[model samples]
Target: MSHDARVFLREFLRDPARVAAVAPSGRRLSQVLAGAVPRRGVALELGPGTGAVTDHIRHREPRRHLAVEVNPRLARLVARQWPDVEVVCADAAELGPVLDAWGAARVDAVVSSLPWALMPEAQQRTIMTAVQAALTDDGCFTTYAYVHALWMPPARRLPRLLRTAFTHVAVSPVVWANVPPAVVYRARAPRRDVRAD
Candidate 1:
């Protein structure tokens, strides 16, 4: 679980915007996200710093669990804590090759803990494209953003981007327990017929 806290603390100190939160996500937020998990199948987690949310996700009973952590230290921590999970030290934008390395054609669900508001538009577009391509026919992609930042131009544009990439997107109730609070985004891959348009 990397309960030591130093993992996230060090990362937060290194890059405030990248780390996003000062502390690991609280349990309430984790529960809210874990609840939205697919019934059963391979699930991918992005930026699982310290595996706080990953810990909660483990209980959701996914047949296969994979986590992509850009930081090697944090990735090692997650792998050590969750022996069954496949942890990769690579950028989320490289999901295609990473999934290929994992021998997964597509995943049923994707959960992200990335700081979308802080990313450049180009980087965001790249990662979003990778996410869309990595998902299976019935796959869904999920991520969260702080409620306070919802008004920011970049944050405001996130939902709009999701709508363009997915057939369905919905925002869940705010998890008040999280510092500064946050809301989850639940998005489903566009149906083949819908994508044809």
Candidate 2:
């Protein structure tokens, strides 16, 4: 694990109240996020943990990325890991300010590895709201949940909640090649005409 990932795991395992920030063990989710994202537009990432997803984002395209991490230590680590990436130390709920600071009026996509299942419903709603507002009309949001006990019904509530705010949403399984298998959720902003008005 990377330094930031180790720190995140230690903090998360020590206190459930603190947000969990484990890195994506494999690149499956990252691949999906890259594939779903646009080529030359800005991308936003929440709880990047240690640049695991950032690495993929860099490799896939030349577009700029803004990675928001609440953990200051992790933010510094990510800065070191990806010198070209803009690592900001801020909460996902306050994404608007971060995007503004980056001069990014609208994001092409939002990819995250935040532990949505562990957060309160209200916080979840807030983060989702911020993400939707920051993304363009046709932007996308992608995230993943562990495939173990973490993949229960309650865990699925995030994707369901996303549907209410987005016109297109999907969940795909990323089998056990990871330390634990995972499922990725991709959500797109509502378009005025999906079936053509």
Candidate 3:
């Protein structure tokens, strides 16, 4: 297994709630998430465990790439591996200040691997609100949901939350190559003046 997979596994074992994936994201899913970004401005990545998606973000050559990981070990590893990347060990909901510290008010793309299925509705709303607020008007937020979990109440409710927050939301075809088969959800930030709060 790759080092990233090993590190991700270690972190997942440490706290499954924090790192909810069964395994590190595969190359295909990473490609899809990274490519979903329409432009190359400040890109914010949430839950970049082991840098699986971070590599692809760098490959896309965004103007500035920032990753926030709740896992301290994973955050350290990402910073060590990608010395230039701004890797912060914090919650995704702190996006606004994190961006401000970097002299950025908006991000063009947000690639997240957060375990939305595992979070409570209130927590999900808080993070989603932060994500919506952090994005630029034309920004896109790309995240995936496990195919098998679609029937779950939280999974079903995810769309409703997104629709309430964004101007458009698109679901990509299932990526069978991923360990547990997943589909990407790409949401366009609302064009109207809106505050997620």
Candidate 4:
């Protein structure tokens, strides 16, 4: 196994609920997710496991890059690997405050590797609410769902939740290269009035 995969496995073994996947995201999926970041603009990444997507995001060369990781070990690893990125070991649900504390009133893009399918509805709403609040008027938010779990309740509920949060939500075609396959959801024009309730 590659170094990243090994680390991902270890993290997943330690906290299956948080680390969700047994391996890091594939290059193709990472590229698709990172593509949402606007060049030279501020970018925020949630749950950058083993820096797979982070590697691609850095190539976009955003003026500022901030990553929020709930796992301390993974956060430290990502920080060490990507020195330029601002790594914060905290819950993604606190995205609003994290951005506020970082002095980034709004970010141009949000690339998330968070496992929304594994999250409870309330948790999903909480994080999505914070994401909407942290994005700029034209900012884009990109996240993905495994194809195999599309019929699952949490995954099925995601689109409805996203539609309520953002004015535009576009689903990508299946990325078969990824383990278990997945589809990206790119959302824009966050509805300012939407709140987690």
Candidate 5:
């Protein structure tokens, strides 16, 4: 196995629920997720396992690249691999506070590799709420779901939650090159009333 896969597997073995995958995302899925990042402006990444997607995001050269990884080991690995990226060992659900601590007023894009399907509904809502609040008026959020999970309740619930939080949500074509395949969801235009209702 490759170094990235080994590292990812170690983490997965340590905490299956949090790591969610046996290996880091493939190059194709990484490219697709990073596509949402603007060429310039602040960009945030959640759960950058082994920095696979981080490589693609760096190529886009966003003004500021902030990555939040809940795992301390993975966070340190990403930080060492990409010294330029601001790596924070924090929960993605606490995005608002993370951004505030970083002094980022608003982010232009959010590329996430988090396992949304594994999260509870309340946790999903909490993370989405933070994402909606931290985004700029035109900022976009990108994340993926495994193809096999599309019919599952948690997968189905993600789009529903996103629709309620953002004005526009688009799902990309399935990336078959990825392990088990996956589809990326791009959401834009945060709804101001997301918290009111």
Candidate 6:
């Protein structure tokens, strides 16, 4: 954590209304990334708060990855740490242009850590729509949500909507040894419609 990060984290902790604590464990990251990501293809990541998932992506090299972070401060940190990875400081909803600029016409997968439960329903739909548009026919987009009683409504509904965009949707539990256990939702891109010749 940088000096500035400490200050930001302190302030975040004070309220933490929007901040959900579901820090990715190295083991859990390996599991989800391995299962969801293809061996070699363009990958995209959203809301990489402190490079927890970013580190995993680096460790397991994809063909290339475009990581978009809304927070400029965190974006700088990720760029500095993973200089090889493409880092963009922008909203998740605005990923199309950035991905095109990065030469990612179609991504194979997107591993996200964007606190989805906290976002408004409309915002969630927008971001997921962007994700769907960016992915290849077989691409998968994976994200995690905190395990809590109150967050259930959105949590349950997200997977269903993901089905509309992706061909497959699966959720798995990852019990974090550190703080709170989380469930990772893996959604595969919708299959392309093929016509019989």
lDDT of each residue in 1-197, candidate 4, tens digit only: 99889999999999998898889999999999999999999999999989999999999999999999999999999999999999999999888788889999889999999999999998999999988888899999999999998999999999999999999999999999999699999999999887653
Which regions in candidate 4 have their CA more than 4 angstroms from the true location?
none
| Candidate 5 lDDT over residue span 10-110, tens digit each | 99999999998887889999999998888977889999989999999999998999999999999999999999999999999888888889999689999
Better of 4 and 5 by TM-score: 4
Which scores greater on lDDT, model 3 or model 6? 3
Candidate 4, 117: how far from true, in Å? 0.8
- Candidate 5 ranges beyond 4 A from true positions: none
Cα TM-score of candidate 1: 0.91
Instruction: Give the better candidate number (2 or 6) by TM-score.
Output: 2
Residue pairs in collision within model 4: none
lDDT of 3: 0.84
Candidates 1 and 6, the one with greater TM-score: 1
Instruction: Specify the highest-lDDT model's number.
Output: 4
Candidate lDDT (C-alpha), each: 0.82, 0.73, 0.84, 0.93, 0.91, 0.70
Of 3 and 5, the candidate ahead on TM-score is 5
Q: Provide TM-scores for the models.
A: 0.91, 0.84, 0.94, 0.98, 0.97, 0.83
lDDT digits (tens) for residues 1-197 of candidate 2:
56556776875676545454343446766676555567877788887775667777787574788899887877898898888788899988787777888888888888887778777777787787778777788888888787764655557678667777788888886656665677788888644332110
Best by TM-score: 4
Give residue 10's lDDT in candidate 5 (0 to 100). 94
Candidate 6: segments with Cα more than 4 A from true spot:
1-8, 14-19, 22-26, 149-151, 176-178, 191-197
Error of 5 at 146 (Å): 0.4
TM-score of candidate 6 on Cα atoms, chains taken together = 0.83
